[model samples]
Every structure is written in C-alpha cells, then in structure tokens.
Target: MKKIEVFRKDKWNMIHVEIQGKQLVVREISDQWGEDTHIFLSRPALMDWVQERFSAQRFEGSEEERLSIIEKFKEV
Candidate 1:
C-alpha cells in the first residue's frame, strides 16, 4: 500500500497524494478557475509526471541543452 501525507492545508480545499519508495515530496493544490477545479503538483513532480504521461519519445541530452534554450529568451 502507498502512503499519503498532507503537505499543506487550506480552507477552500484539502490536498493529498500517494507516494511510493524514496521519491521527493510532492505538493498538491486545489483551486477554482471560473468553477473549474485545478490541481497542481510540485516542480520536480510536475516535470516527471508530464514526461511520463504525455511524452511520446524518450528525453535525450543533458541540462545544458535546456539551459541554452532558456538563454535565447534572456535578452527579450
């Protein structure tokens, strides 16, 4: 069975998540956007989740590639 922990508390919504093994802590947020509910994940968890669920191909290369891409917009 997976363990669940509440990292944050808010009056509007209660946050909870399933965690396994030694993975980094993930945060859950609940909010309303014009009557629609929104749940957000922490940065590290968000990146891993998106890649695992939405990516069709395996990610290649290193962090340098990502840094260089971000550098292109620094002057704008």
Candidate 2:
C-alpha cells in the first residue's frame, strides 16, 4: 500500500488517502475514539469522488505536485 495524502481535519481527527493494489482507500481516524473508518473505491469511482471533492479547492502542495498526485491516482 502507498500513502497518497493525509488531511488533518482537526487536532483529533484525520483522513488518510492511500492506494492498495488497484483500489483507492480512504481511512478516517479519530484520536478520541481510537477507531478508524475505511472506504475503498475503484478507479472510476475514485475519480468521481476526487472531482466532486476537489473541483473548487486547491490542495496543500505546489500546483505541479498536486497535479502529479491526481495523475498518480488516475494511473493507478
């Protein structure tokens, strides 16, 4: 598995984005509960999710790097 990105929602919560084989995996971790929630998506579904989630926002990276990350998701 390869970690693609991590979004820190707050001091106690985080969302981890990763790739396992051909699937995109999203893991939500909460410090308070000591539990995690995971979601898996195939390429098409992952692309749709990415589009809907990130279309109007800029990721926390350089433009070139952000585009590279998106391309990596597509390639996988």
Candidate 3:
C-alpha cells in the first residue's frame, strides 16, 4: 500500500497530496464528510468511485519516472 500525506489546500478547490514521496494536486469534487476522517481522489478514481465504490486500479510505473516528475515540479 502507498502512503499518502494530505497537505494544505490551494485555490480552485485543489488539495495537495503526497503519494510515495511525490506530490499531486487534485480537486475536491464531492465528498462524504462523516464521523472523523474524509476521503479524496483524483479524476479517474472519482469517476470510478461514483459508479462503484469498490472500483480501483493497480497502477504500474517506474520509480525513476515518478521521482523525476516530482523533482521537476519541486518549488525549491
């Protein structure tokens, strides 16, 4: 399982999330605010979840590529 750390929010309803040490900006479409925590997702997952909550995918990518993309976007 991948570890995800949710960061501060930004304008346009975007939330910064760190997955596997890489940061990704995802928008807050709709959510179920219940009990204690919340759940967020990107475009694809949101679509899938809307259709079926159990819908999920096994992503496949190289670590180098992921890290390279993250490094390219690093502010400093």
The 10-residue segment with the lowest total lDDT in model 3? 5-14
> Per-residue lDDT tens digits of candidate 2, residues 1-76?
7885455557677656777776678665778776565555566776786666545464555666556546655664
* Per-residue lDDT of model 1, residues 1-76, tens digit only: 2434432335544333444444433334446522222233444554555346333454343555434423322211
What is the Cα-based lDDT of residue 53 in candidate 1? 31
- In TM-score terms, candidate 3 sits at 0.22
| Candidate 3: stretches off by over 4 Å | 1-59
lDDT winner, 2 or 3:
2
Count clashing residue pairs per candidate: 0, 0, 0
TM-score against native, each model: 0.24, 0.45, 0.22
Q: Which ten residues in a row have the lowest lDDT in candidate 2?
A: 52-61
Per-residue lDDT of 1 in model 1: 29
Expressed as tens digits, the lDDT of each residue in 39-73 for candidate 3 is: 43454543343334222233134555444434432
lDDT of 2: 0.63
